[model samples]
Target: MSDILKGLEPERVFRYFEEICAIPHGSGNEKAISDYCVAFAKSHNLWFRQDEANNVIIRKPASEGYEDAPIVMLQGHMDMVCEKNSDVDFDFEKEGLKLRIVDDMIYASGTTLGGDDGIAVAYALAILEDDHLAHPELEVVITTDEEVGMDGARALDVSDLKAKYLLNLDNEEEGQILTSCAGGMKSRAAIPTRHVEWEGVSAVIRISGLKGGHSGAEIHCGRANANRLLGRVLMNLNKELNVGVREVNGGMKDNAIPREAEAKIVLDPEDIQRAMEIKNEFVAAIADEFAVSDPDIRIELNVECNENRQHTIIHPADMERALFVFIQSINGIQTMSMELPGLVESSLNLGIVRTEEDNVNFAWAIRSSKKSLKYLMSDQLQYLAEFVGGTYWYEGEYPHWSFKSDSKLREVVASSYRDLFGKEARIEAIHAGLECGLISEKMPDLDIVAIGPDIHDIHTPGEHLSIPSVERSYRLICDVLSRLKA
Candidate 1:
């Protein structure tokens, strides 16, 4: 066990958390961790099932006096988003996360901490091993590839399970009970390109230091997207200077806002100083515009003197088409819910832009609670792409987990929180996507409520888990379980 978690309250949770951190379990690469879970269940002499897709279900009988209680299911995913700083050399497929603690929070060195859903797995494992805790028969379902999509939940066979009350341990905030989440789908737009062998002085413009975050949770914050900023700058520069694009690349995941982007362009040597001035002006304007939301936005222009160079540049008209498609498409919170104050009903994120050998691709994620609105937004995106001489498609669509008016699970959890903390827990629906939406579809009769300890800045290298929040949330879960009745 790592000493970073030593002497922490609820030692088992932290122990398991540290142990899981030692195994590389990025999305779609969960075999090692899945087998570790199987070994855990085997060592405990519990019944378990491991599916081909690496989803695991472990069953344990109820503790004394709770035999007649309704069976309870605890669900969390086994995968996490693997992100790192540009200078970091960590590999998610080969190396375990390097754990560290600062200010009572656990973080991974130069990489994402994987605390989003890893904490959930640790909680479930700790609860299952505790012999004295009062609860019904427990069914722990740990799904895989949740960050990429709800593929594991979609493929899992849950018919054999008898649990009807499920507690999803995926929410990031300790005091917020997420009862519903937005439905989402990934869209890809590819614009074909032709190149010509002609070059002048070439320079690369980079945009960085934007406070990128989860595209779903932070889309409404008005954070700057590096990809969008680069596109706008390129278009704006085209109006003043003669420039040809060689490459445009930014972002990695469709669910994360682009934090940094770069574009390589060929320009006349005489326009170098003017281009630098234009870049500085644009940067100043952007910093002022996003001062409140993304105060640390940085736009850097790196120019190298390549004299009489001959390199491939995208055809001028095709480059204009690509830039137009990026600048015109809808990105960020499109509409807010009228019924719920401060709730985002529909949104889009231009999450990634890449320049391939023969084409430039733009990736986006469209989300909405309403199915029609989700498709409508997608249709609009497709129209924008095709209007600019490109083609688009959608994939990995997951449905929304709509809020239920009457929920025994919610009432019990809220009352438990009030009893423990002498205060009310916030109950609301989040705009982010959760696997609960897909799992609820398989088991329509399941009573579900999502809860978790506090994890901040998920899906980014800045992710961290609060130690005190984990202790309080663990106590709350134990209190809720002790109060459960048939």
Candidate 2:
């Protein structure tokens, strides 16, 4: 364990968290972490399996008196979204996260803290390694690549053993017991491009500093997506300057709302001053518009002469249609659930926009609790992409976990929480996607409930894990396990 987290309660859990932080375990890069878990199982004399997808399942037998109890599975994903500040020179593939603590929260230096599911892995590891903990025959299943999509969980084979009850440790908020979660899929539209040589005044117009967050969890916050905002900026400029876009690029993942976006544009030399004035106008307007949700939104500019230097640029006509696809698209909360108060039933986020040589690929992580509404949003995107002569496709589709009305595990968890926290844990459904969705689909008989410590600003560089919440949640988990011995 690192000296900074040495004496924290649940020593084994923090020790394992420090160990996980010391390894590079980002999405699509989980071999090292998977191997670490296998080694732990080997050293602890537990049966384990590591699949080709890098998903690990470590099993421990029940304690002497609890052999008759039903099997329980503790689950979490092994991967973290590798996001960092553009200025930070951190190599996620080569180096581990640099962790720091500010009072009660633990954060990574200019990178994601990985507490979204790392805490889940650490809790499961600590439970598996502790011989005295009164869990039933435990199946500690840790999957990978959950951030991009649930690729690992989708490929997992669950025919080995039986687990009637499964507790997912991937929930972010500490006090909420996630009973249901929305389904999701990746939507990509490759807009075919035609290039032209344009030599004139060129500038890189950037929209940045917006409080980008997870497309699902925080989409309702009314934060401005930098990629879409960039499109709006160009549309405003083209009315006077007739700007031709060279290459528009923004965002990193299909699951995170872009914090920064920039476009290289070609325009007439005389219109340069007008463009600046237009940018300033929109800056003031957007700042006032998103003041409450995205207070730090900014639009910046840097001009240069592209004259005498021929460059490959997209035709102004084609680029204008692409901009329209962004500005006129349906994004954010599409419909609110009347059944559940304050629940978002359907939504989509323009999570990524990239300029390729042949096309500009726009990808979104579409989400909805209702399957019909989910595909309806996809249909809308398809029409927009085809209207602009672009090819549209979708992948990484996953199912949803519905709310269970009769659950013995929920009552056990609630009773345990009240015993420890002096109040009932909030029973609710999150709009975000969870592996429980897929697991419940595969193993329909399993009673699954998702819970976790307080994870703030997940899928972003500002992510932090609450220290006290971890300690409390671990206590509640242990109590629940002890009570489930029947």
Candidate 3:
């Protein structure tokens, strides 16, 4: 707790947010938080249920005079992405998030703050307790494992819910309503590695200091992918000199852009200086290429002899094929939206690459508003993998929510926002994957609109929430509920 957010109007919301921070509720480990919500409902004497998938739904009767209004569902995920700084010692599964207030923002120390969806959960809890606010039938649906997959939302029995309209509290920006989002699928390739004896010096090539971000949300920003850059360096080295790769690894999460990558290779002693020269040239080219997005790119090389080397290096032919395929893989925004100017409609991210004892694995994720485009991208990746003598696989495919131009609830929300703020509000769509896509599949006719307070750097260590924006956003939500009852 800091002085910056001490005097906020939504004291109850902040209080619950703080309480949730103290709990370790990472994406897959959400049982504790789910139980906590259920207990809170029982203590407050509100009707609630814990479904088979651990999704919680709390039902509250309408205010005295608003009983005739249609029911509205306040939706948000209960789980948060488990991400931390590379040097942070805190374990996401055991340790609570350490929150700090800096100026007008609230953030966690060396870890994600979970403000992406936690604020929505807190707001819904506070609203349920506030007897003064005017609203119709309220149903708070808190689902689990939304960060990894929309398992809870997908498993939900829509027939059990009475709400016809849903307000998803998962959007990152305030003053904007997200009407649609892209569908996505994970693509992976496996390349078998064969080791061969090497009689050459060993060196480590490392790439670091790149500004990485969310592959989906920040792809349109034109940030550099470290894995791809590293592959470029390897391809150049193989072309100019004789090198045998012993190990290569980079990046962790599939959803996040890679910041650093390193490779260990055995090469002739005479090629060490030439490799360093090429590394410098590659660094300069990358800096100029990603000047606007990643200006701090760095590449370095270290020469050292192996003292206890027991294994052989990968064959030169195999290394060349793998490096070439990796460098040729297209990453980032591939197509722009025709319907919305400057919006990315289809994109791909080369998320992770690793070398194990006998195989090399490459992981990628593709997101698109159009199903045909997604399949096209997948086919391209599979072709690349097959051309390089590897096998491709797909996982975690989810549907996209197509935009509905004549949504009744969208009209109501737009008019309500204009009346409250005395101006027009932006109704837009995002390229990132959202749980609404899966929820919509279950409830075809349910009207959905996602909104939230201003939050930045979600799914990363620098995540934070804007206090002022949150206060205003909460008030606006209440106004929307009031207008709905009228």
Candidate 4:
């Protein structure tokens, strides 16, 4: 347990958060964490179910005289996006996050601080453990594999849940209530590769310093993806200096904007100077192009050449196709919502590119609030990949949670927030994917509203949760629960 959270108000929330951080609950690796939740439920004498997908639903009866009140469901995913700096050697499957508190903000040393949804689990646990809090019958649903996709939510049997009002504690902002979210799918393409031996100079071109962030939330910000930028550099070098690529690798998760990418290439010794010149020009052009969105963007080259050294290079035709996939792939917001000014309606992020042993893989995270638009984007990607000598497929498809014209759950949450803070809370739709969409499909009559404390840089190493906001939000949720009626 981290003593950093000692003496924090709403003590159990922080304590449970630290406890969760001590477990490696990354996406696709939540069995241990799921058992932990079951154990917690058993110790408290609560009814619980652990499904095959590792989703856990614990039932807590209403307190004192609140049994007849409407059943209010608290929902959040148990899995967290596992991302870390390149130099960090932490394993997402086994090792726990090295948590630290600085100036009341909690973060991991060199890895993502899974505060995005972990805090939600912590909040639910704290509320469930407390014997004095007033609330309706509670169905605390802790889901799994939400970062990669809403796998748990998709596989969950919500038929057992009788809760009509659901409070999703998964939003990032403290004062904003998100009632709707964009649908999303992960698209992947595999390009064929043929290796050949060639003697020449070998050098690495790296693009770094881009302010990468969440693909869905920050895609409209014009951040330069390191994978895309590297593609541009390789294309320019091939055109200007006739370079041959050995391998290209960058980006971690499909949901995160790549901050850095590296391409290893082989070229004639004579073209080294020309490649350097083109690299500088491209870097300058990119910096100028994304000056507002990625001011700190940088490009570097590290060279090691030997006249007699032979290196393996991907076949020229295959290399061109791979480069085209990286360069021509559409990224960022594709369309804006006309009805809601300043809202993104459709977008895609070319989030990951890697050179495999026999092929190069490219992946994009596509999102749209409209189902048709989402399918259209996926179709475009499929065509692009098949147009070349590659194959494309989609996975983790989740539905869009459209904004409701009238939601009593939203009304209750907003009114409760205003009553507590003396100010109106913002109601809006988010571009990111949430489990609420799938859950709504399972239980169409469920009225859902999402809220959470302040968390910044989610899905990245800079991710941190605000301690003060957590405490404040804890109080707000308790107040909201007290205010709910049948």
Candidate 5:
């Protein structure tokens, strides 16, 4: 509890947010949260339904005069990505997200704030409880497991929903209506590893302090991918020095940019000093290369001479192949939309890389608005992985929501926003994945547009919510509902 949030408007919404923050609702672990939602609905005596996947939909009848209006659906995911600072000891599945308010922004203490979709849930709850706000019949869909995949939303039986127009409360920006989003798939490459004896001195080369971000949303922002950068260093070292790698690890999640990477390698004792010098030179080059973006990049090496104690190391040939493939993997935005300037049409993220007991696994995410392009990029990644003597597996493949220029609900929302703010609202497409794609697949005629208050650093531990933006967005949504009913 902070002084800043204590005085915010719509105390009920903030109160609910605080309560949710105190609940452990990580993806795939939403039973407690789902039960809470069911209890809330029961206490209100509202009609509700819960699917087998734990998705909950509660119906609130429109105010007296608005019952005849078209039904509107308010949607947001209940589950959140469980991310934390490397040094944080909190367990996401059991520990509540510790929240703090600073300078009007609400953030978690070393863990994700869950504002990505939690604020949406709170806002919906507030609206459901408020009898004063004017609105048409409302259906609030609180879905589960949206972070790992749209499991809940995808599993939901859309036949139960009567809403023809849906407002998704999952967008990160205020005043911007997200009408479409890219389709995405997570691909993994696994290469078998056979460890060999460590015949020389060992040292760990660590890279840290690189600015990592959302692989999809921030891919075009030119932020350096630490995994790719570390691979480059390894490739260069293998060429310049006689070294054997014991293990290489970086990043934990597939969606987040890797902030740190460490490589354990065995090098000739005589080459330790030379290796240190090379590490410094490489760091300097990277700092200069990403000066405009990752200014805080750091690279360091620790030296220790030890006999060949390990049972094995990755074969030299396999290590070279893995490093080369990783370096050659093109990441970030590969194509820009011709119809919309600066919008990413297709992109790839070299997300996670790690060495297991017997194999090395690399993860990637590819997103595109065009279905053909999505598969094209995925095929390319598969080919690249095969070429490197690795196998590729895909998961969480979701379709893109194609933009519709003549959406009636879009027009209604736009007019309402203009009437309230006396200015035009921006309608745009996002590169991030949304459940709207799968929902639309089930309900073809459903008109969907996503909106939300301003939130930053989503899916990361640095996530925060803007209080003022939440107030404004709340008012806008209420006004939009009023106009739709009228």
Candidate 6:
């Protein structure tokens, strides 16, 4: 184990956590981590299964006196989001995260700490290997590609799972238990375009320093999407003068709000001066509007070719279609839940935009607590994209992990929490998508709740995990397991 987390409480759990951090386990690249888990099971002499999709299931019979109790499932994904600072030179595909510590928190040097679910994997592995624990039959599941989408959970086979109760260790807060979460999907819209040679002036317009975050978790924060902001700047500029797009590109993932976006455009030489004035006006207006949400927002325009120059740009009609999608696509918190106060009911994010040789493709992440609402938002996008002669498709559709009227597992967990902390744990619903949504769709009878240690800023470079919180949460999970009865 690395010295950064040396001598931490629940030493076994951190040991596994440090071991896995030594391997690159980003989403869609989980084979190494999956195989690592397999090797762990082999060394421990535990029964396990490794699927083609890199999902792992390790089964352990209950302890001597608890064999008659109902089976309990511990679940979390194996993959982490690969996010780093632009200046960080680390290679996610080939390098292990550089672990560091300050005060009670653990962080990876200039990269995401992967604590969102990696700690869950460590917790499950620790329990699985502890033969002295007084627990019911255990089924520990580690899934893959959960950050981009719940692909691993969607493809997971639960027919053989005997667990009637599942404990999902994917929640971020220590004292909060998530009983329900929103359903979501990722979509792509491709607007066909053709290039043409033209003689004109061009400049690259950039929007940066916007505070981007997980689309589902932070959409209600009112931070502006960089892609949408760029679109607005271009749309207003185009109306004043003839403009043709050389290309537009922004954002990295469909599920992350864009932090930076840029576009190259060709326009009349005489319009360049007017465009600068318009750009300044927009900067001041937008800075004031989003001052509270994104305090550091910036816009920069760099002249690449100011003189009449030969250039290849999108056809006028095709450029119009691309711009139409940028402006017309639905985004942000669309509705607030009447049932749950202060919760977003439905929303979407125009998370990514890319202009290529044949098409200008736009990607989105749509989320909603209600299935109908989620579908309604997605359907609107599909039609709008098609309205402009573009093609649309989608993937990673997940169902809502709806709150149950009464849950024995909830009672057990609540009782355990009160016993340990002398206070009630917060039980709430979230706007974000958790793998519980996919698992519940497969095992409707399973009583499930998500719990985790203190992890902050998940899916981002500044992400960190609380070391002390991990020990406490691990004890709570263990206590909960000891109380489970047939």
Each model's total of backbone clashes:
0, 0, 0, 0, 4, 0
| lDDT of every model, 2 decimals | 0.90, 0.90, 0.85, 0.90, 0.85, 0.89
- Alpha-carbon runs more than 4 Å astray in model 6: 267-269, 305-308
Query: Residues 1-486, candidate 6, lDDT per residue (tens digit)?
Result: 456677888999998899889899989889999999999899989999998899999999889889789999999999988877666899889899899888998999988888878899999999988888899999999999998889999899988898989999999888888899999999889999998997788789998888787787788888889999999999889878787779999987888888889999887788888989999999999989998999899898878966898899999899898899999888999999999899899899898899888999999998998989988987999999999999999888888899997999888888999999999998899899999989998899999999999888676677889988999999999999999966
**Per-residue lDDT tens digits of candidate 5, residues 1-486?**
333356577787887888787788988899988988888899988999988999999999999889899899999999888777777899988888888888878999988899978998999998998889999999999999877767887789988788889899999998899999998888888887776686777788888777777777788878888788889888777768888998899876787777778888888877877887888888889988999988988888886555644535788888877886678887888889998898999998887899998778898888889889888888888888899788988888888987877788899888888988899999999998899998888888888999999999876788899988988898988888888874
TM-score against native, each model: 0.98, 0.98, 0.93, 0.98, 0.96, 0.95
Candidate with better TM-score, 5 vs 6: 5
| Candidate 1 residue-wise lDDT, 62-104, digit = tens | 9899999989999999998988878789989999899989998
lDDT of 2 by residue, 1-486 (tens): 356788888899999998999999999889999999999999999999999999999999998789999999999999999889888999999898998999999999999889978999999999988888887899999999999889999999998859999999999888789899999999999988899998777789988788888888898888889988998898888777777789999988888988989999876777878888999999999989999999988798778764645667998777877888878878888998888999888899898899999888899999999999999999999999998898999999998789999999998998899888899789999899999999998899899899999898888899999999999899988999999988
- What is the model-wide C-alpha lDDT for candidate 2? 0.90
The window of 10 residues in a row where model 5 has the poorest summed lDDT is 303-312
lDDT of 1 at 470: 96
TM-score of 5: 0.96
Which scores higher on lDDT, 4 or 6?
A: 4
**lDDT for 114 (candidate 4):** 92
